[model samples]
Target: MDRQTEFVLRAVEDRNVKFIRLWFTDVLGFLKSVAIAPAELEGAFSEGIGFDGSAIEGYARVYEADMIAHPDPTTFQLLPWRTKAGTARMFCDITMPDGSPAMADPRHVLKRALKKAADKGFTFYTHPEIEFFLLRADAPWNAPEPLDSGGYFDHTTLDEGTDFRRDAITMLEQMGISVEFSHHEGAPGQHEIDLRYADALSMADNIMTFKVVLKEVAVGQGIRASFLPKPFTEHPGSGMHTHVSLFEGDQNAFYDATDEVRLSKIGKHFIAGLLAHSHEITAVTNQWVNSYKRLAWGGEAPSYVCWGRNNRSALVRVPLFKPDKASSARVEYRAIDSACNPYLAYALLLNAGLDGIDKEMPLPPEAEDDVWSLTDRERSSMGIDTLPRNLENAIAVMEESELVAETLGEHVFDYFLRNKRAEFDEYRRQVTPQELETLLPRL
Candidate 1:
């Protein structure tokens, strides 16, 4: 057995872990788990646990439902919230009975993308500033009541949000997830947590764990935590503004101290690639129908396809350079919502950026003024294009992109498109309250 696998087994025994939850994600990024007794750890590591893939959201058909989930020992961590005999968890990689990686596995898709980056002598890293809202537990799904009225960075002596964040952070840290910052966002009851940067794979795992920890803590407090893109019509929406960087042998590939913007040729090309393919990838980054609502009503969430230095209005923002911390040089893609499947989202992002580097795409002119403020004519004249205005438009654009198709593989690409189209169809037929309110009295 590998050292990591042996170490995991030893840890489970030493900790007296009663159940070990093997975790994986569906194509749409929902967490799925299956618990096994500690005695099965060794067998799981070697042969994997069998499950019915057809039961999952975007897995195999019923006839070919057999699948295996091989636990990644490197991701082993005990659940801080669980007590008594204790419970631990490990992220699993889905595979077929023959041990071949599942093409539809979102985690495998990311690994494939990362392998491409590795082949190019680069490593991808991401740091996400995830935002969400805390609502009253008893609040109705349609009418969510905010747990607190505190606005951005407002910290009262005895704030419920603050206590919740504290507890959440504690649980995360216990699981070895390092948090960089936590603060109240601009919207009432909304909170933001910035996780320390890590490799794309590990960071994706952390994000998944982060969401579960938040929800667990919230439920324990008689509250509900939501990662919905636009939970409330009048309030600012939650977003996962992720900072991404590429590295080579301990050096930041994006750093060019001598350049005017301190961005190297590689960095510029990456940004250019993201801008070029922003529309095609929007369906994955902002997948939900409501995600468009958040993007269109822009304050922090950007709707246009452009990049700028310290410009939050643009889709991609290059944070100001700190000469002392060249490693910190990176670009933030702001359109990604907290609810996105991190694995697929990061895969598409890495592939897009890598495509730019491969092609040496030219960086477009920076949006000096706020993109949201610019008139349609002015934006068009400046060559600044807006992202797909809605999920339908976004899916249409994605459906035609070879880059998205190739990166996501045939299994995922076809399933995601079909699934999203069905979702949009269902959503369209629904009679929303706003539509009734406006049209009922008129027509």
Candidate 2:
């Protein structure tokens, strides 16, 4: 047996594991799993577990429904909250009955993007500042109410959600997920957890697992966790501000000690490409109807396409360089929300940066002032472009994007557009409470 397989099997036996969960994500980025008893481990590791692809959103048509999920042994980990005597989980790669990688799989989309980066001698690393809210457990799914009045970095005495975060972080650590920091956010009942950087693929898997664990911990504590982009309008929305860096072997490709900004030409070009294509990818990066609400009503959620040093107002910002820590030099994309499909989001960011590198795009000037507050004349003079205002416009922008289409593959690209269109229609047809309150009496 290979080392990975041997390790997983031995761990299962030694730990007295009774059940193994084979985890995979559907195209919409929802976690889907099937549990297997101990007797089924060998066959699963060898031949994989089968499921009906037709039932999954954007997965397969009725005619060609057969699919398989090959468990990745390296991802084996015990669910710390569950009984050790037989519950473990591992991520899986979706494949066709014939063993080909499923094109519709979000994981495969990311793998293809990673391969493209590999061909150019680059490795992608990402660290995400994932933010979410702890809400009243009794609240309806459609409308979540806050659990506390805590604001940014409040003490446990003031931040009622503190113990919940501590518990969640402990459980995450036990599951082998390394968290860099956790604290209350700017909004009441909202929190942020920063995960240490890892390779793009491993980080995506961690993000998926992180969401599951966060919800599980919240429910156990008699609270509900939400990653929705804009659950509240009066308060700041939860965003997944992401830090991105490129590596060429052991060296940080983005760093240049001699440059005034300390960003290499490659780094500058990468940011330029990201800025150039930022509009096209928002439909994927900010994929929900409510996501545009966060973007349009900015609360540290960037909508302008510009980059700067130490400027959070810009869409991308070059973080302050740490002396002797070359790897810390990276660009932070601020527009992405915690609710996005991590695999697709990472893919677009990498590919967009690569495109800029290939084109040798020149970096634009920094926008140090608040872009949101800038007058139209001033913004136009600065050559800064705003992101799409709504999901309909975002979908339309994505429809015309060659980069997004190629990155997602035809299966996902087409399905995503169709699905989003339906969502827009459903949303537009609704008579919102706000409309009823404001318009009925006046009209």
Candidate 3:
């Protein structure tokens, strides 16, 4: 066994871990776990544990159902807030029984994208500003009531859930997830947690773990934490405005001291690529029927496709640069909701950015004025574009995009397209209470 595997073995024994959970995610980003006793862990590390992939959504066809879960030793950590006997978990990579990477595996999708970046001597890093809501436990599942009536940065008294948030942060820290900041967000009962920047893959895993920890901590209280993109139509919706930067070796590739915004040619091109592909990747980033509600609403959710310095109204914004902090230079992509599948979302993002780098796509003019407030004439004159307005439209956009199809590969691309189409159809078929309430009384 290698050093990391051996270390995990020793650590599991010392920690008195009764079970080691092998965790991965489906295409929709829902976490899936399978546990093994300590006696079976060494074998799992060497040979991997087998599972029926066909049973998993977007995984495999019935005939080709056999798949293996190879636990990632680096991701080994004890599950914090586990009420049961000592339990640990590790993220796993799904592969075919013949040792080939499963093309449908979201992790494999990201790995391919990362390998492309590596080929160019670049590494992608991300810091996500994840936002969600804390609601009363007994609140109706469909219409959850906020636990508190506080808004943005509301202190101890206003933000009544400080203890719960603190407990969540503690649990996350215990599991080795570093949270940079946690504060009450603009919406009532909504909060934002900014995770420390890390490589895309590790950060994706951290995000998945972060959500679980948040919910677990919330359950411990008399409340429930939700990651639904737009739980309340009247209030601002949750968003995962992600900060992205690229690096080469010890230096930041995105930074250019000579440039006005301190952005390198590479950085500018990368942003240009992102803008060009924003619509194409929208389905993957904000992949839900309700996600469009968040996108369509113009508050913090961006509908227009444009980039600018510190312009929250634009889909992409280059955060203000500090004179001494060159490493902090990055672009924040604002359209992604907190509920997205980080694995596929991050993969698509990296690929989109790389496409820009590869094609040397030129950066468009910065939209200093609020793109959201602009009239059609003004936006048209400025070449400003808009993202897909709904899930069905987003799916159609994804279907036609050669770039999206190529990035996701045939299997995932086909599966994702079909799955999202069905979701949109189902959503369309439903007669929402709002529709009935307004139409029945009016007509």
RMSD of 3: 1.1
Candidate 3 yields a Cα-based lDDT of 0.91
The TM-scores of all predictions, comma-separated, are 0.99, 0.98, 0.98
1 or 2, greater by TM-score:
1
Error of 1 at 418 (Å): 0.6
Worst 10 residues of 3 by lDDT: 156-165
Query: How big is the positional error of residue 27 in model 2, measured in Å on the Cα after superposition?
Result: 0.9
1-443 per-residue lDDT for model 1 (tens digits): 98999899899888889999999999999999999998888999889999999999999999989999999999999999998769999999999999999998999999999999999999999999999999998879888999988889987776789899999999999999999999999888999999999999999999999999999999899999999999888888999999999999899999998888889999999999999999999999999999998997887889998998878999999998574478988999999997899999999999999999999999999988988888999999999988999999999999999999999999999999999999999999999999899999999
TM-score of 1: 0.99
lDDT of each: 0.94, 0.92, 0.91
| TM-score for candidate 3, residues paired by index | 0.98
Cα error, candidate 1, residue 320 (Å): 0.9
* Model 2 C-alpha lDDT per residue in residues 48-133, reported as the tens digit of each score: 99989999999999999999999999999999878646599999999999999999999999999999999999999999999998
Pairs that clash in candidate 1: none
- lDDT string for model 3 (209-290, tens) is 9988998888878789999999998999999999999999978999898898889999999999999999899999999999
The candidate scoring highest on lDDT is 1
- Extract clashing residue pairs from model 2: 17-86, 18-86, 19-86
Question: How well does candidate 1 match the true structure, expressed as C-alpha RMSD?
Answer: 0.8
